[model samples]
Target: MKMAKIGLLLDEQTANKKWAERENVFAFYMKEVLDHFGIPYQVISENTDPMEEMDLLIAGLLNESDQAVQQLISYIKNGGAVLHLSDSPKLARWAGCQVDCGGPGYGYPAKELGYQKPVRFLKTNHWYRAAPADWNAKEGFLTDGSPEGPVIGELWMTIMAGSGKMVHCQADLPYSIVGLQQGLEPIHRDGVPAPDGTAGIDDGLLKADDSFTMDWSCDRETTDTGMNYFSEAYADRWREVFYHKLAEMALEKGLTVPFIGRWPAGIDQIATISHDSDFNLEESAEVTLSLLKECGIHSTWCMIEPGYESGMYKKIKQEGHELAYHYNALEVENGVWSEMEFKRQLQDLKTKTGLKHFCTNKNHYTLFKGWGELFEWCEKEGIQLDQSRGPSKKGNIGFLFGTCLPYFPIAWHTEKNRKYDVIELGFLTQDLNHHALADTTVIEPFLEEVQRIGGVAHFLFHQLHLLEQPKVGEAFRKVVREARARKFEFWTSEQISRWERARRRIKIDRLAPSGEPELSGEAPTASPVIWVPVPKHANVLGEEAEIRFGHLCIKKIPVFKQAQTS
Candidate 1:
């Protein structure tokens, strides 16, 4: 019935402590995750009573004193909930057992997290150094039976000791929250201006215009990961099951998971197809466009070549596809007047084609490199969308910003506060992820995964992929066909961008304890869509919630409450 009141407890003594340190990436991540899911939490002072003042005390307090650990033990024994990271033996002790801290400390999955292998729950393979808590796998015996470890790993375990629950996680939930400990660019010794971070708003040339700057590097994603040797952009990739449950464990009712997409009628996932052209002039440009045209779909093409005289480029524009500018990073790296060239090329394209607005772009090689200069130029040119922040890695489509959805990139500096008027559509997966990067032929598995997740699948297929091989085009056709079969509505880059623009306006004003859940917001589209969490707890049990766009009722679905943990 109420939100979880989370607390980041200080050590017993409050001297020389900074919980928001860069090294405390996990702490930052936990805060972001809590905010992302609308879970409210506060920082508790060490002098406060954990049993009284807090429903759950996040488990970093144990690092301070034996007395602190004893307090934690006492709190849990009396039914207090806590979630602690690291391979600390204190967790095993809380479970009335000892921890084995001598196991492998790399990324690995807790086999029991999901029903499928390669489940979205990716960890550093760190094992809790000991036998399975409360159970003997070798002897086939049980030590205790009341509160079993649902997420049982040799590295971590959750114990229902007394009335309290303790999740001893060794794989480091912080890393999961913020991929690759060093998410932010290097900050100065004084922690003022990060290396790639803007020196001042003026240096970034960020003006007081109608611009909304977004730091995709530090914002909420539906779910994101960019760890080496793994991917975090799978469908339904919200992998904080244990942490989420732990938060709910503190709540008497249950948890509330936000619905991600803005498709009409509560569609779970959105589908997109795009192409970024590099030097593949001879690439299968015609075949790809023809295929999309035949399938009755429009896409966005990031163009680099000057195709003023080319019929194919004209056909691309005439077919209702969007022409997004593509800037080459190699030219920038090679000092080839890259910025100037982009400006000149933009002018040339407009001059030749009489195109009014070049509203979208993707870096030829994702050379954004955390700079405001390029964005400054983009602002001057009136580009409304940037698709460069999609990948966490150069070649892979892992979770960089923890989401593949579109968001207004906000950039803030100490000297000046500014919002750049640009929507960043982070890339999800691309043709290269399989063919060019991994050299795989069949992308059925990848497409299947995208449909399974039911989020935006922004695929970047360089027409060049199908230059010599018709199979590439055919395979992409299969992607479209299969998506249609699954009820996925295809959209061009501009269409999706417009949808997001309208979606930002759709809002949930409040959820009442009775009556239809009150919603607030306007959609410019004729058949606009929205998803809102139902009236929670008992208010949701006897009835369903209705969602709408203007006078049109889009959905009247039952309120399916999240799994009640407590």
Candidate 2:
């Protein structure tokens, strides 16, 4: 196997040290992309790369010195691949497109990555627009001996320097993406004021069924990854753009890779029928439980603060239904309760229900407010899973991370410094929408798309929706029957949370540089449904592994054997 060395070049002026030290979204998500593709990489700085031992070097908006620019150009011309994201004013002569510094330096609205975005070596003509078009560089400008003129098209140019290739891509990707992910106003993407404090819930808004909707938005260009949910949304095409580019770079260095899907098992889609226990579940528990029983579904029931052990406890314990906790956001927002109160709440629930610990969680208002602090509480309080990363502010309902599968969040933790895996199951397509806005029309297409892509199709329903809007009982029944008809995996929230932890622990290893690496851990037990993705082109060396789309599904083996060749 050939080893490929990829280096990330950094500029001092723009490389924020704090962001680098704390939660560096760029580095975190970039590594996620690389690891998914089985590509290994390292960070390279100006002072670093002395011997120039890299096959490819990636850099941000190049605002460095003239000497620094020439050094990279020389490397590329000498047979190295250079991916210069956004503009590089210093490399105007070689790149064939110069940054239009005379044009607006900033104040441009951000747009999603488009298919027509021009590229050089990439086989696909499309791209993921992580950042907005802040740089105004005209592509394919015919350069005279010195003077620049006759700029043609959106300035994305490519040049051949001896045996090497250089591409002046006209979009600022990682830089702007980081800002957007952190709920910041993407002024560079859209000329807007800085992010006004955290998004505020609407005062007098409620769904037709009287269920709460978390529809939020910012004036600036926003993404589901952030808070703004109600505003005009932009499609996050990161998967397509990043995957294509990574494959392109690897092929340049001689490597093949496959796209990673969300769901693990052969299950194309996942559906969770969750009932939020805002009202006293012990008294009214039979109502929701009977509904699930009628639908042939064992749903997840989450409680606000279980005060006493009642019929609900016996049902959850004996009936195979899952138990979870819910925090009331209105109590906190209205200053009626503090976070510390949850500690007592957990104890009260355990005492009443005789359940030692709780694992999964949702919120009263489906609020992600103070989630970081809430996660810390979850850790100290023994909560393992959180299903709160939804993208609704107060009226409209949608996806947050836009996936159905569960994942450990990287908001505060890094790879080396670890804590418990805060499994975030992205909640998409809630039940409130069907009655509130007749969004049943909007759901079928999404479910079909999820099936096509082999993703999850999770839906949340408040007990109030069932108790108050008795008219929409058929709508809920139809969704469950359809899911059963499709054979989608029906797991309780607790089951999903436990399964995700087990999934993460089973590390799938592959070869270095060529997209697959090594696994270093073990799962408590091999599950028939437990599946881990391996490289599509991986050589399993006669190992008993199920290969689908290059993913070697780790079968249930009592003894964990290292795949010597895979």
Candidate that would win on TM-score: 2
lDDT of 1 by residue, 1-566 (tens): 23344676534342224332212323333544443333345755456554445667675434445665677777778877776655445545555565433221222233323324322222332334355434323211111111131433433456667876775555445444333312233212121221232122222211111021122222212222321212344212333344434433443324222322345554655667778765547336777767887888888888775543556668778888888787665543342334687687778767666677887888765544433556667888888787765442223334434445554433323212134567666565456433334222223444445455444666677777756555566666776776677777777778777776665544333344533233345534534332333232324444334421111122333232233344
lDDT of 2: 0.49
Could you tell me every candidate's TM-score relative to the true structure? 0.59, 0.66
Model 1 stretches astray by more than 4 angstroms: 1-26, 30-80, 84-113, 118-156, 159-164, 180-263, 279-289, 305-319, 332-359, 366-441, 464-469, 494-511, 514-566
lDDT winner: 2
